[model samples]
Target: MCTEELATWRDVSLVLLAAEALLTGLPVALILGASLRRLSRLMVGMRTVLFQARMYVWRTGEVTRRAMGMVAAPFIQLQSTVHGLCRALDILGWR
Candidate 1:
């Protein structure tokens, strides 16, 4: 009879421990869920910002390319004209 009482007390203690663990874990789980939700929202905002930044970089690069081409145009035209004059002089035996 003493052994049966001891066994019943052990079972009761085990049930109490499990209940305590569940109570402790519930709030932790809820906090983690909320943190994940906030993180998801932050990631979405970051994605939009990054996309805008990428577009701006692409546009800047395109503008730079066009500017460089415009800056080089006169030099290219002068060189081509010089080359054509030399070719014409060579054809006429002007050396």
Candidate 2:
């Protein structure tokens, strides 16, 4: 082929490649924008959930601590009394 004709075909090929690239890239850009929007919303929701979970954990820990404190002395006393009784019974050969 003549150099001019070959150059013309090369130009056409380049135009076609550029057009195809634009067509392919446009949708990818749009999809990425949509994905970013969705991701932003998801992040906001996750932040709220994490905050609520942290609050719940703090409240539950406080309640548990108070409940344990209320039960602690009684529980210790009961355990010691049981131990003493067992020791006395063993000394008396009542086991």
Q: Which ten residues in a row are the worst by lDDT in model 1? A: 65-74
TM-scores of all candidate predictions against the true structure: 0.53, 0.54
Model 1 per-residue lDDT tens digits across residues 3-78: 9999999999999999999999999999999999999999998998999999999999999999988998889999
Clashing pairs in 2: none
CA lDDT, candidate 2, residue 29: 100
lDDT (Cα, 0-100) at 64 in candidate 1: 94
| C-alpha positional error of residue 89 in candidate 1 after TM-score superposition, expressed in Å | 38
C-alpha lDDT of all candidate models, in order: 0.97, 0.96
Query: How big is the RMSD of model 2?
Result: 6.0
Top candidate by lDDT: 1
Best by TM-score: 2
For model 2, give the 10-residue run with minimal summed lDDT. 68-77
